[model samples]
Target chain A: MQTEEEFKDFILNGHLHYIPNVSIDCAIFGYHEQTLKLMLIRHRNMSSWSLPGGHIKRSETLVEAASRNVRMHTGLDNLFLQQFKTFGDPNRIQFNKFDKEKWFEITGLTSWEGNWLMDHTISVGFYAVTDFSETVLQTDISIAECAWFDIGSLPPLEFDHSEMVKEALHTMRLHLYHYPIGLNMLPEKFTLSEIHALYETLLGKKLDVSNFPKKLIALGLLNKLTEKRSIGAHRSPHLYSFDREKYTLALKEGLVLS
Target chain B: MQTEEEFKDFILNGHLHYIPNVSIDCAIFGYHEQTLKLMLIRHRNMSSWSLPGGHIKRSETLVEAASRNVRMHTGLDNLFLQQFKTFGDPNRIQFNKFDKEKWFEITGLTSWEGNWLMDHTISVGFYAVTDFSETVLQTDISIAECAWFDIGSLPPLEFDHSEMVKEALHTMRLHLYHYPIGLNMLPEKFTLSEIHALYETLLGKKLDVSNFPKKLIALGLLNKLTEKRSIGAHRSPHLYSFDREKYTLALKEGLVLS
Candidate 1:
């Protein structure tokens, strides 16, 4: 190991040093009011919005950083997060034609001179679908506003973020067919329509309501209840809840839903 | 656009290092005559062996880096490399701490201190299942020796790569029930016994040969020619080639083999 003094000297004089560019961005997804919602943070100064994200520290592992970033952004405790993919394109950021001096001057909160604004960035994209009802997000000024965006109508995003969103949504769709996901999006008990609406939001289309509920219930991921839909004008749909015990057991047993 | 001057100054002052510590190590697999092969390399001047890997460049993506490194080490081209996971345990190098310094020294590489080196290091893991019969691998001194190790009998590996092997194998096993992936390890087309043997090597047990041929022919991933097995006192197993047309179409249409 280089001595601390050597490290400081090395930092001060090294020519064209390399830094691993790693940031943790979460695709915090949830189902709300019959729509699949994704958590987004609007910028304070820049005319852009983003998935909650930040850099990983020297001591933090990738997963740790992701969980921490998500919790800090969403105020959700003990939330489990998994890294889905890492985007590393030499040209991924050509859009950031930020003249360094000017961009730094413009975003005055940062000191570019001392910050070794490394360019070789590899972003690890993580995903977690949780329930909207339990999330108590602590909003930050760095994040001027926070809200959930319906998956069907995502606004244009800055950077390659739009592509990242597309990729995450694609992965979620695949997972839905093969795995018992989106459990965190619903309540302790929900109707078939709620689940179908959630699926529609994610898929950006409607589903055959007649076939979906039977297929899902047959998957054994959901537990049926004696309760009927508590509030509805049409014929009440049956109430159901995720069978966490069986689902968790099946997942641990390596059941690939597909 | 970050100016060349700003990029240079960022490198010189340690305020913006560009080299990435994240590397990609591939656990390439191939199936041969009743055997499974794992591609491995011996580091120059080191008795220990490692998976084919290299530094992720600023302009480079993980897929590019892993494929390039594998090609460089083995003179192999167009191998199917898949990005599966990233390994970043804070202290994964407790026993092999000196290996990193020694490898860099031998390679005559410079550091991108501070933001690059001191900040963090994250490595992504990729996997490739190739048809060894088609790849023409070139070996060099950068890697003193290269060989395909049998999965059942692998020597100890350097760093945390052994764990990476386990994960890759798990992924491969997960694919077996769905599609015939080990075909990538075989020649253009050979006999039914050859295919069965390859599975035995992976499964680590003997299998009944009588029913194997019928099952493979039913998968429609193979085409049987009038050729017969030439070895032993038995009829030659029919030579077959991978149905590339079906494989490509299946993958494109997301028609999972299972």
Candidate 2:
């Protein structure tokens, strides 16, 4: 980590080389084991959590900045991402000054204990959907912890990250059925029950079991395999997978995620 | 109009109170006479026209800034507004230096002419929908003219404002039928044909006349007014208006715009 003077210089002088007063935050939503999760990071010496985010370099587009942050925090790449919203309230940065002071205290940076970190800034919010089972959380010197939290129960986050997460969820829910987002979260082949569970997790409510399957089948984006899996007590459920060509065509035509 | 010294002071000192590297642009789209249009403004002494935009103030939210810009460019209030996208390409601002320099030259500013106006800034795009017949263009000292241009035949705009307009149109189209936006652009009492014209203008295509009315009626939000409108060489069409209470209920239930 840089000393107080170096950090101050990085803010006042070096930051000009990047896009000043602008940041990008990623609300990486993942699906695994029939649950939806969001990736969050805790800065070194800070107790409050926040989404993995950083400033945009002068040479990069906003999407590239979000992609870089997702890779840096999750050790995963080529994830499906979308820009959902931009949060630009002037008070967003300074809303968590107490957290900053606590962080400074633990880090022993007395000289840097001021409003420098709480300057007015705007943040663009991007969300990524990835397979939670394949992602490995990565930590750097500045990041004390990086992990996925259950969507239903998230801890208090610094700044307006909680609001960002809420907004991302709302946008995703609005676009979920119309887009092929859930398909990317599942494996190459899965059961009907697995896809239904993913939708329930995202929508935060159990769908009508009998009606949902019929609706999904009517959409005709899936191919039922001849093989079946038999649970100990239940009847055998046939395996199914997305027909890539049909799925793409349905997505292009704005069909519901079936 | 500010003098050279005043302009310099505004740029160097006054702007410090606002977020340095973030701006807001307004793409005010209007519907009038079966046509869609966009509002554009020309800065004093600059040939290139641009959207009405300004840096976000430290005391205001992004939506407030956008609302202020819409009011500044068009003398209309309580318009239907939404934030569509953010344009953050580093080269978006300074790419049009000749116009910026022209603005500086006419303002009689020499001290702050080099790159002060060309700073790296990210612009949050907002779009407003309004009845075009009711809006009056407002021009201030810094603005040479404010005018509405037909969406189908827009003149060249400065920087990336044209791209912003295109993006806003695309978003509005996607959400058009899914939201109650067309109601805001229509009068209190209108014929079915009038509403159809507005949708056609917005969607950039003609709808199936026989099917459009049936689809709208199925939503069950409009009231049949005991009025009719007649045009030359056309049959008199019955007038209709929204049942305010039922409309609000349908809107809350996420009924497609009708």
Write model 1 residue lDDT over B89-161, tens digit each, in one string: 7766443443445534433446523334344456788888775555666565445677878778788888788
Per-residue lDDT value at A204 in model 1: 66
- Global Cα lDDT for candidate 1: 0.64
Q: What TM-score against the true fold does each predicted structure earn?
A: 0.73, 0.83
Which sections of candidate 2 miss by over 4 Å? A1-14, A95-116, A191-193, A206-258, B1-9, B103-116, B208-239, B243-258
By DockQ, who's the top model here? 2
Candidates 1 onward: DockQ, in order: 0.33, 0.51
Score candidate 2 by lDDT: 0.75
Candidate 2 residue lDDT tens string, B1-258? 236565556555655667777888898998987888888998775778888887787889999988888887777777767788888886886654454456455456564543434567789998899988888898766677889989988999988988999888876776665556666788888888877888788878877773444555677667777788876677888888877776666544444342
**What are the Cα lDDT values of the candidates?**
0.64, 0.75
Candidate 2 lDDT by residue in tens digits, A203-245: 7777777344455567776788998888767788988887778
Candidate 1 chain B least-lDDT 10 residues: B8-17
**Which ranges of candidate 1 are over 4 A from the true structure?**
A1-20, A95-114, A136-138, A177-179, A190-246, A249-253, B1-18, B45-47, B99-119, B133-141, B173-183, B186-246, B249-253
Tens-digit lDDT track of model 1 for A1-258: 124444443334332332235666789887667657788887554567777776665576777878887787777755535556778877665434444444443344354454444445667888887876678775654456778878767777766788788777765655554456656677788887777777777666676773455666777778889989747478777889888887676544434443
> What does the TM-score come to for chain B in model 2?
0.83
